[model samples]
Structure formats: structure tokens, C-alpha cells
Target: MIFGNFVSGLIILFERPVRIGDTVTIGSFSGTVSKIRIRATTITDFDRKEVIIPNKAFVTERLINWSLTDTTTRLVIRLGVAYGSDLEKVRKVLLKAATEHPRVMHEPMPEVFFTAFGASTLDHELRLYVRELRDRSRTVDELNRTIDQLCRENDINIAFNHCGHFTSP
Candidate 1:
């Protein structure tokens, strides 16, 4: 097993599917590659825990190297509004929230999609790209705040699912 793992490690080093500092998701683990050894690799997850995985797993299992070629990543935000809201205005507000954000990419351009007719609302999706993975959280935070403010100002009610059950004799 050691001999096989060493060979697998060599393959991983050369193929470079993931490098030190690269963010990846392998199986149920998502984290940054901290070290690559002859028999195993170490990943530090977002929670700051370190996980050691056998080198052969990289060759056999599917891997997602989020920072392999480029650091750009897409973020999707789903929004639902009251049925009577103005669709055009909602689109404008979502676009405004994305475009005005500093970290959002202008090259790909943000998109607003009216996705579905929900039981209680109109569903919309905001698709935007960020230049770096690090910007995802902050971008979403700012955009959500902006979108909520804009929706309120425009008199758009952000919808929520309501469930009720009653049993009577």
C-alpha cells in the first residue's frame, strides 16, 4: 500500500490537480491544501481543522479544484417577492445590487432571472461572479443588505413560505 501511495503521490504532484493553498472539495471535505506527502495530503477546512487523506484517493475519486485555473467563482442568490410586485422593478433592483458592488465582476456581467411562479410569490435568481473566492462572503453580505433596502424602498415585499396545519374534531 505504501508503494502504491508513493506512486500515486508522484502522479498528483506532476498532474497538479491541486497545489498548496488551492481550495478544493473532495468527497464530503472542502478545504485548502496545506501539504502533499508521499503517502497522504493534508487539508485545512474552513473550521480550521486539519484532515489527512491518502494520496491514492486523489487519483481515483472526483476532485474539484476551485482555484485550479482561475479564482473566479459564481454566487447565486434566490429572491422571492410578493405576487403583486413589479417584475421590471425587481429586476432593476437586483441588477443594481450586483453591479454596484465593488467585488462583483463586470466582465461576465450579472444576470437576474425570474425563475418560477411560487405558491405564494414570484421567484427570482441573481447570478453574479466574484474575482476571488475570498470575496464571496462579503459580496453576498453587502448585496443582501443592499437588495433588502432597495426592495423596501421600492415597496417590494420579500416573500416567505407560510405553512399552517389544523386538526379539529
Candidate 2:
């Protein structure tokens, strides 16, 4: 069965299930593929550590390729605002933030979903696409900063954990 690894390596080359420089999550690891050998595949993880995964694992385990089809990748930013905040304003603020960011793609036209009502807040999700996978982090940070600023400027408060308090009467 050891030859299975070699065969799997060949399959990868021919099938092109994954490619070098692609960001993928294989089993417990997620990173950019640095090298693909006959018996092992290497990835440089977010922590900057090189991970060597057996070629058979790719054949057996479920895998994800964030940049497989194209360099464009969808990312979601989830946020919660204190209840009673104006929903319309919230949507506009998030939309503007996405549109203003240069790295954010315009075609998908970033969408904001007024998802749920929380115990202490209103939960919403911002879905956007980026041109480069590597820009994801910086784009997120920019979006977050913008959201924080917008929330502050608009007097919208970002909510925290809320729990029912049982008081002894």
C-alpha cells in the first residue's frame, strides 16, 4: 500500500487536484502549498511553519482549495451591534466600507446580510470577494477598522456577550 502514496502523487500531477502556491486546508492544516513531492506535500501555514502531509492524505482526506478556481476568494465578516441600532444605517455603513476598500472586488458588489437578532445585539454578516488570497487579512483589518470608526461616528455600539442574569429576590 506504500506505493499508493507514489500513485497518489502522480494523480496529483495529472489530476491537478491542488497546485503549488495555492492556499488549501487539508485535514487539520491550512496554508499555501510550497512543494509537492512523490510521497509528501508541503505547505507554509499562516504561522509561517512548513507542514509536510503525506500524499495519501490528499487522496483520502477531504480538502479545501481557497484559491483553486481563481485568485478571487469570498470572505465573510460577522459583526454584532447592540439591539435598537438602526438597521438601515448599519447596512449602509457596512456596504460603504466594502466599496471603499481597494482590495475588495466591485463585481460581486459586497453584500450585507441582516442575519439574526441576538440576546443583546443584532447580528449581521458582510460578504465580499477579494482579488488576491494574500490580501484577505489586510482587507479584513481595514474593514474592521472602518466598521469600528463608523460605529463610533454613528453612535452605534458594537455589542458584547449577553446572558440572562438570575437574581435572588
Candidate 3:
């Protein structure tokens, strides 16, 4: 097993699947690569915990290196509006919110999709992209706040689950 791991490490070094500082998701673990050794590689997850993964796993398992080709990442925001809300207005509000955000990449052109009609609401999805992974969290937060404000101003009611139970007396 040690020999196999050593060989796997050598493969990883040569193939360059992941490197120090690369943000990656390997199976259930997602983090930045902190160190790479012949026998193992260390990753620092978002919570600041260091996780050591066997070199063999790198060679054997699937990995997603978010920073590999480009740092540009896409974000999807899903929202629903109460039934009877104007669909056209909702689309416009979503587009305005996304396009006005400074961190959003304009070249890709944000899009809004009327995904489905839920039991009690109309579902919509806003898809947009950001230039860097570092901007993801802040961008999402600001966009959500902006969207909420915009929806309220437009008199659109964001939908929520409504449950009613009737018991026979």
C-alpha cells in the first residue's frame, strides 16, 4: 500500500490535478490544498480544519479543482413568488438585481428561468457568474438582500410553505 501511495503521489505531482492553494472538492471534502507529500496531501477546508487524504485517493477518486482552469464560478439563486404575482415583473426584478451587482460578470449575462409552478407558488431561478471564487459569499449576500428589497418594492410576495391541518372532531 505504501509503495502504491508513493507511486500515486508521483502521478499527482506530474499530472498536476491539484496543487497547493487550489480550491477543490474531492468526494465529500471541499477545501484548499495546503500541502502535498509523497504519501499524502493535506487540505484546509472552509472551516479551517486540515484534512489529510491519501495520495492514492487523489489518483483514484474524482476531484473538482475550482481554481484549476479559471476562478470564474457560477451561482444559482432560486426564489418563488406567491401565486398571481406578475411573472414578467418578477423576471425584470431578478435581472435588474443580478445586473446591478458589481461582482456579477456582465459578459455572461445573467438569466432568469421560470422553472416551475409549485403547489402554492411560482418558482424561478436566477443564474449568474462571478469572476472569482473569493467574491462568491459576499456577492450572493448582497444580491439576495437587493432582490428581497426589489421584490418588496414591486409588491411581489416571496412565497413560503403554507400548511393547514384539519382534524375531525
Candidate 4:
């Protein structure tokens, strides 16, 4: 076991599925790698909690490195709109919001997808790349706020589930 861990550690460090300060997902935990020790790698997640993963597990299990080859990471935001809402306008608004964001990468540009017509709303996904992998969460939040404000101002309804019967007083 000791020998295996040592060997696995070297492989991870050298082959570099992920390195320290990289954003990665391993064994269901997605976070930034804070430390890489001989036996294990430690990560700090969004909540600031440390997750220690064994080097052997890293070698054995599937590891996803988001910033491995590209610091530009795609961020996805799925929003549902009222069935009657205009998709053309939605596309424009979504693209505008993404383009206006400071961290959004302009080279790829933002794309809007009309994914599905759900039970209550028309599902749409906005795909945009961010300049920094670490900026994913913040960028998403800002985009959400901007989308919401724009939706409200433009009188676009973001649909939600009102599945059950309800009475308005």
C-alpha cells in the first residue's frame, strides 16, 4: 500500500492530471487543489472545506481537470421562461448579458440553446466561457443577477413550477 501510494503520487505530480491551484473534480468533490503531498492531494471547495483524496484514488478513479489545457472555462446557466416568451429576444438578452460581463471571454462568444419545452417553462441554456477558471462561480452569479434584472425590466417571465393547485388571496 505504501509503495503504491508513493508511486501514484509521483504519477499524479509528473503526469499532471491536475496540479496545485488547478480546479478539478475528483470522486464527486469539485474544488481547487491546495496541496499535493506524497500520499494525498488536498482541495478547498466553495464552502472553504478541505477535502483530502488519496493519491492512489486519484490514479485509480476518474479525475476531471477543468483548467488542464485551457484557463478559459465554459460556464452554463439554464433558465426557464414562460411558454409564450420570445426566444429571439431571450437570445439577444442572454448574449448581451454574457458579453457585458467583465470576466466573460469574448473570443468564443456566448451561445443560447433552446433545450426543451418543460412542464411549465421553455428551458434554455446559456453557454459562455470565462477568462479564469476560478471565476466560474462569481461569473455565474453575476450573469444570473444581470439576467434577472433584464428579464424583470423587459417584462420577461422566468417560469417556475406551480404544479399543485394554489389560491391567490
Better of 1 and 3 by lDDT: 3
Point out where model 2 deviates above 4 Å.
162-169
Clashes of 2: 0
* lDDT for predicted candidate 3 compared with the true structure: 0.95
Q: Between the candidate structures 2 and 3, which one is better when assessed by TM-score? A: 3
State candidate 4's TM-score: 0.88
lDDT tens readout by residue for model 3, 4-117: 899999999999999899999988999999999999999999999999999998888998899998999999999999999999999999999999998999989999999999
TM-score of 1: 0.93
How many residue pairs clash per model? 0, 0, 0, 0
Note the Cα lDDT for every prediction shown.
0.94, 0.93, 0.95, 0.90
TM-score (C-alpha) between model 2 and the true structure: 0.91
Backbone clashes in model 1, listed as residue pairs: none
* Ranking of candidates on TM-score, top first: 3, 1, 2, 4
Best by lDDT: 3
Model 2 local distance difference test score: 0.93
List RMSD in Å for every model shown.
1.6, 2.0, 1.1, 2.7
* Every model's TM-score: 0.93, 0.91, 0.96, 0.88
lDDT of 2 by residue, 33-53 (tens): 999999889999999999999
Alpha-carbon runs more than 4 Å astray in model 3:
167-169
